[model samples]
Target: MMNLAVFASGNGSNFEAVMEAVKSGAVQGEVKLLVCDKEQAFAIERAKNHGIPTFVASPKKYSSKEAYETNVLKQLHENNVELIVLAGYMRLIGSTLLHAFEHRILNIHPSLLPAFPGLDAIGQAFDAKVKVSGVTVHYVDAGMDTGPIIAQESIYIEDGDTREDVQRKIQQVEHQLYPATIQKVIEQITRGV
Candidate 1:
């Protein structure tokens, strides 16, 4: 099985979703590690509950972004992680990790992308009053969500839908699409496509 790592920053709902997918054999790899930037992030507890290894790399502890990412890189290398998945990982990936895992990282964003590229994407879509907004799974490039899209699934925003409603819908889609997309990516990589 391929070794995988998940980077998460908050409540870890998506992290949990991915773990569930792995458990159910919907995804064809093992989540070797859980990396979190926040010490107190609930994702750590989630990882622990599921018997997964956890690593915390707080930026404050390192002298530079590269330093922080270097530590993370060491852990990933030690675990032989082949694929890195970003699940609400708030920090922008720096060159240290980016160069180390070029085109091997994936991120699931809460918007169709090329549209609300940064934080609070669901809020951005809601504020724009768009009739349709969705989730995107893409390769993690140097730019902010500017990577080549791997897959996108759109959700219709009702006229009266609140931001919370849209967020909920987007998250539901994320939980499903992210794992399926990851599976497809793994297939492509294994096939050398």
Candidate 2:
């Protein structure tokens, strides 16, 4: 079975969705580990509940970002992680980890991509008076959210949609899209497609 190492930095709703999809056989893989940059991130507890190994390596603890990412990469290699999933992970990954994983890292961004590509994307859309905004799951490259698109689902922004409301809707799409994209990637890998 393919092994996934999920990284998260907050409530872990996306991480939970991935785990649920795996449990329901909607996603064909095993989450070997869940790593968080913050000790307070609840994803660690969620991983423990699902019997997955949990790790916390704060970037602030290291002298440089590369050093911090090195620690993360070491753990991922030790666990034989085949894929890395960034589920609400708040770090801007540097070249060190990108060189280690290359196209192996996947991130679900809260925008249709090529649009609002950074933090508080939902707020950006709301402030920009966008008509539609959704989710993007893609390969993680060197640039922040500047990777090859895997899949995108567009949801119409309502007339009075607040940032919170838009975020909730985007997150719903994220929960479904991330796992499905992972499955598709696995299928492509298996078939050499």
Candidate 3:
């Protein structure tokens, strides 16, 4: 089985989803570790509940981004992680990690990508009043959400939809799509695709 390490820096809804999916064999992999950049992130708590080992650290405590990632890389190696899955990890991956993981990292974005790429993507689409907005699962690259797209599923924004409504829609899609995409990617990784 592929050993996986998941990174998150928020509420960890996606992290939980991935954990549940893997537990149910909907995804083929073992969650070897959970890496969180924030000590207070709910993802850490969720990881604890799931009995997943966690490495919680703040980049601010490290001297540089490379130093922080070097520490994270140590944990990844210790856990024998084969893939890095970014659930809600808010930080930009540094060169150290990018080089180490390369095509091994994958991320799920809250927008159609090439549309609203950065933070608060759901809000960006809602504010723009776009009739359609969706999720994008992609390979992680150095640029913000600029990786090659693996899959995208769109959702329509109704006339009276609130920002909260849009947020809920994007999250629902994320919870479903991210796990499914991870499963497909893991299969490809196993097949050397």
lDDT of 3 at 86: 97
What is the alpha-carbon lDDT of model 1 when measured against the actual structure? 0.94
* Reference-based TM-score of each model: 0.98, 0.96, 0.98
Model 1 alpha-carbon miss at residue 132, Å: 0.4
lDDT tens digits, residues 102-177, model 3?
Answer: 8999999989989999999988898899999999999988999999999999998999999999889989999999
Give lDDT: candidate 2, residue 110.
Answer: 94
**Superposition TM-score, candidate 1 onto the true structure:** 0.98
* Pairs of residues clashing in candidate 2: none
Question: Which 10-residue window in model 2 sums to the lowest lDDT?
Answer: 184-193
lDDT of each: 0.94, 0.90, 0.94
RMSD of each: 0.8, 1.1, 0.7
Off by over 4 Å in 1: none
lDDT per residue as tens, model 2, 1-193: 6899999999999999999999999889899999899999888889989999988987889999988888888899899998899999988879998888877899999998999998889888899999999999999987889999999999998897777888889988998989999989878877777
